[model samples]
Target: MKLNSDYWEDRYQNNEIGWNVGKITTPIKNYIDQLKDKTIRILIPGAGNGYEFEYLIHKGFKNVFVVDFASTPLENIKIRIPNLDKNQLILSDFFELEGKYDLIIEQTFFCAIKPNLRENYVHKMNSLLNPKGKLAGLLFQFPLSENGPPFGGSIQEYKKLFEADFKIKYLEIAYNSIKSRKDNELFFIFLLK
Candidate 1:
């Protein structure tokens, strides 16, 4: 199946986003809470509904940006965070975006793409960050197969994929995952190599 803008947009149009957690997950919130730099340029690609964006803004992180080609989710974020800057709410394909970010967030986005594009995803993420920038967040740890937008992946696969361009700062099962995802997700931090 084509997992393009039309496919993802359709998911939002049909209210079929099971991957959306409705709120920022605990692991990400805890990470953000510990960050001292409020001015860091942060990017959240494929941000469905942007709960993280709202959470970051509420916490006073002023340089947050989110991109998702789906109109429904971007509109939802605008309604939720009424004061969000239009320039930062990017309604475009993640792979086509061009920018340098201090940090990039990964939620369910990586797995949402087709498995063959995993390598390209890594390259795109590497190019999007400035030197020493980081790509951090959660990844599913289940077996991968040909059956989903919520495709599964293992820790080993992720390491092998990202290590070439990023220094693996942390990669392990997340302790604070919401109960629904406990033991099934890995929280990771990959800094530019």
Candidate 2:
């Protein structure tokens, strides 16, 4: 239950990653489609199999990077993106990663970590962004409990956790989420405070 590299690597090794939806979810995909700049330095933390990274690169984004503590998914990304730059695939703890990004893509990463680390995740994400940078993507909406890596959260909880540090540009139930996640995901856009 440490949720460390070994924990995650084992999940990948055992094919137990339930968080991966097999493709970029519609909310995120629609967000990416509206992005006008392809040069932005982007980071996707806990990016299992990196469908977002793959989508970005294929769409001509040049500075996309994905970090996961597990080696298996990073290798998976490398194989899928045969021309990928080595520097773009980072295998390290998300909190230990150092970089300034214009945008940070959050997927199931927040839910995977122990809830106690939520504040630390916020701090690290803020530090890793360039001035006025955005932290965007889905957050699960449900009751919180001790039973999961896909931990659930509610809108009130998320606001109390993030509002002091980020401008809540948008926080609402996602209208375009994939069917399985419909009504259970909040699509958000938070800019640095």
Candidate 3:
């Protein structure tokens, strides 16, 4: 119930990361494919296994970073990308991380946090980005409940939570999500306000 670093480290040690899709999901891949800038600083917080980090680096993106409280996934990424800068593979609490990024990619990170901290998550994300920077990616679209690290959320809730700090560019059911997540994922692009 703590959901602390120990909890996450145990999950990795036990190989219980269901939120890890093993590869970058389609919605995110498509979004990345469209991005023309390869020099923008990007951060992926709570990046278990860091599939997106791998993809970004493979696509020639520089200045990409990933942070996870658990060391296992960060080590995995290091092994997977042996040449990746050590500094870019941040093994620390996401909330404690400091930097300005052109973009922050959200995957299952939001859902993994306790719901009560949702407001703080928004503020932290807002503070992390530079002016006009973006926070984009998929959010699971299901009812909130007590039974998960994969906790669900809806567009209305998201809008109310993020609108104060971001310009909602797009928020809708992701048409290209992997089969398991089809219709259950909302892809969004929120630019800093």
Candidate 4:
């Protein structure tokens, strides 16, 4: 099954995005709250409803951007944030995207892609970040299986996958995950190595 624009659009059209928690999850919100630089360029790839994007704008962040191939959520975002710059909403494949951001906010994008693309995703993220940039957000901590866009992975797997490209700042159970996610989520911060 191709997890392309059509697949994702169908998901949104059918309300099948279980990973979308309506708003930015608590772990990421707490991380964003502590960030001292509001000017940092931030990218949230595969940002379904862009709750993080919405929250950042509310918090006075000006250089935030979100990319998604599906048009449904992007249109939804436009309606929700009428004042948002249209250019900041990129409609393109994340791998083909080009830019340098000081921080890339990962929510569910990592798992949404095919498992075979995991290494490529890491490399693309590496190329997208500016020097010493960071990638921070939540990752599901569960068994890997063939069943989902919300496919899961363990901390050990994540450490091996990201360690060569990033210095693991933290990779552990998320203490503040929403009640639904609870102990099933991992909050992480990784700085480009």
lDDT scores of the candidates, listed in order = 0.92, 0.93, 0.93, 0.93
Tens digits of per-residue lDDT, candidate 2, 134-154, equal: 999999998999898888999
Query: Candidate 1 has what TM-score?
Result: 0.98
RMSD of each: 0.7, 0.7, 0.7, 0.7
- Candidate 2 lDDT: 0.93
The C-alpha TM-scores of every prediction are 0.98, 0.98, 0.98, 0.98
Candidate 4 colliding pairs, count: 0
Give the Cα error of residue 1 in candidate 2, in Å. 1.5
By TM-score, how accurate is candidate 2?
0.98
Angstrom error at residue 27, model 4:
0.5
Candidate closer to the true structure by lDDT (higher is better), 1 or 2 = 2
lDDT at residue 17 of model 1 (Cα atoms): 88
Candidate 4, 192: how far from true, in Å? 0.3
Clash counts for the predictions, in order: 0, 0, 0, 0
The TM-score obtained by model 4 is 0.98
In candidate 3, what residue range of length 10 has the lowest lDDT sum?
17-26
Query: 19-55 in candidate 4: lDDT tens per residue?
Result: 7778888899999999999999999999989999999
